[model samples]
Target: MDITFLGTGAGRPVSGRNVTSSALRLPAARGTFWLFDCGEGTQHQLMKTSHKLSRLERIFITHLHGDHTFGLPGLLSSRAFSGGTTPVTVYGPKGIKQLIEMSLSLTQTNLEYELHIEEIEEEGIIFEDEQFTVTAAELEHRVPCFGYRIVEKPVSGKLNAIKLQGLGVKPGPVYGRLKQGLDAELPDGRMVYANEVKGPSIPGRVITILGDTSPCENTVLLGVGADLLVHEATFAADLPDKAVEFGHSTTIHAAEAAVRAGAKKLVITHFSSRYRQEDLEQLADEARVLFPETLAATDLLTVPIPRIVEPRE
Candidate 1:
């Protein structure tokens, strides 16, 4: 799996940073791309990248802020012209349906693919498929907002070819059968066990995305031990008063939450346009003091999921 940060600026677009948008790519799902947020200029951003618009199967909007969803109508319209035939599902707050309908109607634009929109106000599990399950939680923002937790069940462990070869097994359908945990029988009535060939299944990966929010109980709960925590750090701690007034977070607060929640890595984004490149890196450095694995996100940066391995018995 890989995560691509399309835009990370908060409120407004900066020269280097665009806005709050991210694309989650699941390698196990034929490179399925799930987008989060669609700030202004999102279609242009997609045009600049090699990402296929058609692979965008699901789009989850954090809130109704212009910085978060202004690019929806344009992206939706362009998807059809850009060779996107598969139906797309847009999940957001209640008024999203009305807004999308109004925008499409006012512009006299239509879509070729089935555009499915789901309105979410409450918290809990909101999405599921063979690849992943997404849980939504209400967040403390100025307006009705939500955060999403994406949990992915991984594939079984890699087949140990050397171990199989040592057991006099040739590479063929037996390897597939062993991976499927099926024991094979030989002509001599010998049972070739799957356990003798396949290793233990690896643990699933949990990725939590924190939308614009203040320090909240559920945020910490959902972020606990997350492989990656994408949180908003709109300001520094010195501006705590301003952060509270604006319903945003500081770098210190965002880092502390990740530290307290035991997240493997902390990715701080949704930065205010006031800071420069050096300043964003400084924020990441500040987070490193508490959590060594920290990243200051930029547009078009893709992060591959860290491989996990279990110790042999």
Candidate 2:
């Protein structure tokens, strides 16, 4: 899995950054990408990247803020003409359904594919499939905002080819069955056990993405043990009062949250417009004092989440 930040500025667009938007590209097997917080100009932002509107399978809106949702109607409208024929689902807060419906209705825009909107009234497991599970929790924002925790399912270990070969089992269809944890008997009447030969299963990755918020318990809960924690650092450490008053987080708040959650890495975005491109490094430096793995996000920055492999028992 990989994350591509489409826009990284807060409140409004600047020359160095746009607004809030990010794309989570799943493996090719999934054949689609999920969007988080589609701020204004997000469609324009995607035009500059390899991610296409047609491959946008799901959208998870953090809140109803204009900077986080102004691009939804335009993007959804463009998808019809962009070769998007498959159904699309959107998950968000209570007002999300009304927002999309009214916007499209007023514009008289008709979509070619089915559109499903889910309004999240309660916080818990919002999405779950065979491959991934997504949990939502409330955050301390001006409006009702949410943070998401995505956990991928564990992948089975690979078959031990050397061990299988030693048992007089040549690579063939039998290898497929053994890989599925099934017992297979050789032509010579020798049975091979899948568990005895297979390596240890690799643990799935955990990713936490939060909406605009101040430092709160939900932030730590959603980010606990996350492989990648994407949180907003909208202000510098020196602007603690401003951050608290505006319901935003400072660099220190973001870094401390990552430390409390035991996150492996941190990517801070939603920067205030006051900071220029060069100033981001200093903002990141402040956070690095508490969490050295923190990185400041820029537009179109793609971060790859590498799989964790476990050693054989």
With candidate 2 superimposed using the best TM-score fit, by how many Å does residue 80's alpha carbon deviate from the native? 0.5
Give the residue spans of candidate 2 off by over 4 A: 171-173, 185-190
Q: CA shift at 73, candidate 1, in angstroms? A: 0.3
lDDT per residue (tens digit) for residues 109-145 in model 1: 9898999999996788898878678999888889988
Q: Candidate 1 has which clashing residue pairs, if any?
A: none
RMSD (CA, Å), candidate 1 to true, equals: 2.1
Against the reference, the lDDT scores of all candidates come to 0.86, 0.94
User: Alpha carbon lDDT of residue 277, candidate 2?
Assistant: 96
Give the deviation of candidate 2 from the true structure as CA RMSD: 1.4
